[model samples]
Target: MSPDRANPPETSLTREFLAALTTFGAMGYVVVVNPQILSVTGADRHALIVITALAAIVGSLFMGFIGRLPIALAPAMGTNTVFAMAVAGSGVSYGTALVMVLVGGIVFTLFSASRLREQVVMAFPEAIRTGLQCGLGLFIAKLGLMGGGLLTRDGHFGDLREPSVMLAGAALLATPVLLALRVPAALLLSIVAVTLIGLLVPGAHGDALTHLPAAPVQMPPWPSDYTFAFDFGSFMNHLALALPLAGYFFLGDFFSATATLIGVTRRAGLMNADGKLPNARAAYLADGLASMVGSCIGSPTIAAYVESATGVETGGRTGLTAILVAILFTFAMFFWPLIAAVPAQATTPALVMVGVMMMEGIRHLDCSKLENTVSAVLIMLLTVTTGNLVIGLAAGSFAYTLMALALRIRVAPVLLLTDLLLAVYVALSALTLHH
Candidate 1:
């Protein structure tokens, strides 16, 4: 047999489909959750859901075709929080807020298209990279544990006997076993198994955990209030108020997408031997473009989703995996209730399992250096505690830079500028995004 023929073709199509299914299972909650968040602006709920799916579809397509990685994209939770609470809650119209998102996307897309964005990402030390990876992983695991019904957000245990908790437990236990046995599509299988369990078993109220919609497939509504609904006039009228908000969206999207891309690609072995990300420009450009397209379609700050790790954990390595994700998003738009039926609890195990797999990056860190250890640990710890990837990276970068300076080590000028900008964003977030 020829040596060239010995290599597998990015795993089988069946595995790619399974990986995409696992990814969708992990992130499907966004279809429901995003609408609720955006509805704070008084947008129509039905419209938001449809737009949310559409945003995912568009972003995933960009990532699949341009970025060409296993990662998927969707409306970001953090930026949406900012858009709803800070931008819209302050009394700007939802349309005005979307205008801000649109402008921000344009700015990010422009910057990402240039090599400067890649340079900024490459300037960071490996410690920061490792921290970003381990941090996002831990945060995901925390999300799983919190949503599994066995634990509160503040670290307390919930009613352990709750039916949801029990079901999550079943999945939590089952996923690891499937993984250990090297089963194909283990995470996807675990999610399906748990969903079936939810359908059959009686809960605390003595009813099935999931109540299926009478009709599984319903045509999605075309958004009347949000699609191409930018209030550019209102945005222009409120330039003083709108400009800063747009700046936040632009800067935040830049950093958050950068962190997610670096973390997920590194996890997928997509980084070059020199430890720099390959196709960083296209990946970032796709991320920025996704946000722009999403904002126009009534979503906010669409970028690469961290939950794409679940697909990577299942042997996905090529863009085909992301294409399948886009395909699933298309189905999700049409079959909203069917998609929604898979509750957060069912997918908690896959997230938890994928998160566990993500922690493997830590072992490869340069533990011999105290600075590296401290910076990486700080990033991982703060990332979870703060529930923000960019914030965690900023904090770790500052720590790393400070240590380097104190030791009289030379730091890149680009990194110094990035740290300064990140520090400003971190300070402002306390009063805005995370507020």
Candidate 2:
């Protein structure tokens, strides 16, 4: 391609702002859905709404000013579930979970800025990479079902007679149609639509499905409410347990952010002839720093969002597009009351749809490589059956390593180390479970 074809023209300020608006319309659902997902961990929903918005705001600003890319960022879906379900639900406090996230972010930042980033990327095994994404997707979908009360704690179907469960069911069916129609902010709209139904429509109980909140509008929360709120002491006292969780956060953030940045930049024709992203370290650094900031502010990983591709496709070619996105997120922080009022049933649709999308990565698995394919398939099956990300990951890693050795495939030295670490982690976890 010619030079002009390789890079799109610079966008005018008005166009950049419009692109930003479009980008937010595509992903702004996270402003509400994130808190709903994370709130299960016993964190304050109101505080989380503000923190989620703040994470997006800070993340976008970093991408704009430092990375100089149009992509936006926010709390990632998979790692959030890992933090909420696998870590906090397994007896770890939310405060200590945040500390784990912070530590992971720091490590990711250090690696992202050095040659380690390239080396690490090269070390990824295709089967494991594909497996992680698909398995994580299944886990997220499971959470959505249970969180919406559509499923019982034992994974049995809940009473469909409940009005809230019915509404959630309806939302699950409606979200895809909205997405098909290319509706702006389709996920957010689905959430709000279901919430409104739960508010106004009555069922056999002679009442609306969901209870009313104390109010509909309130002042946004201050950063002081969550700044430095993590339990560093707990994390320090439990390094063996905490380190594994931190490793998940680190690996998940690294893969998701790098993949998103590559896809978005390539779509925008910003990749060089060598297929290298310009200012790669800067972009990775911004992503890592945002995750650390997100943890401090009561959120999980904040990384580059794939939804920002809407901005890129809409002719956003400059950092100004991302800056505009930051300003919009800042405005969203004020609607905490309304966002907090959105029930898990309403947001469950988004979780399901996102899970479905994540599962699309399964196609990347090469069936011709039977040994490699087994790893990905096993990961997804184990993850769904066990309802634990760590268990699925550890077992799948060991299985993959064994398969590679048996097939006479050369496994990367890093993967061998990973297998050893996973073995240690599983042993520690078994001890904890028995105790």
lDDT agreement with native, every candidate: 0.76, 0.82
lDDT of 1 at 295: 81
lDDT per residue, candidate 1, 140-209, as tens digits?
Answer: 6776777677678778877867878888987798889888986655776776678778898766588887
Q: Tell how far residue 102 is off in model 1, in angstroms.
A: 5.0
User: Candidate 1's error at 398, in angstroms?
Assistant: 2.7
lDDT for predicted candidate 2 compared with the true structure: 0.82
Residue lDDT tens for model 2, 1-435: 544345655679888988899999888988877777777777777788888899999999988998888899888888888888745557777788889899999999999889888678668687888888988788787778887788888879978877788888888998999889988878878888888888876644787755666766667868575687899898887776677778878888888888898899899888866788866888899999998888888778887889999888888877788899999988778767777777788878998888888988878788898777778888888878876777777777888888888878888997887777778878887898899
Q: After superposition, how far is residue 272 of candidate 1 from its true place, in Å?
A: 12
Best by TM-score: 2
Sliding window of 10 residues with minimal summed lDDT for model 2: 1-10
Error of 2 at 149 (Å): 2.9
Question: How far out, in Å, is residue 315 in model 1?
Answer: 12
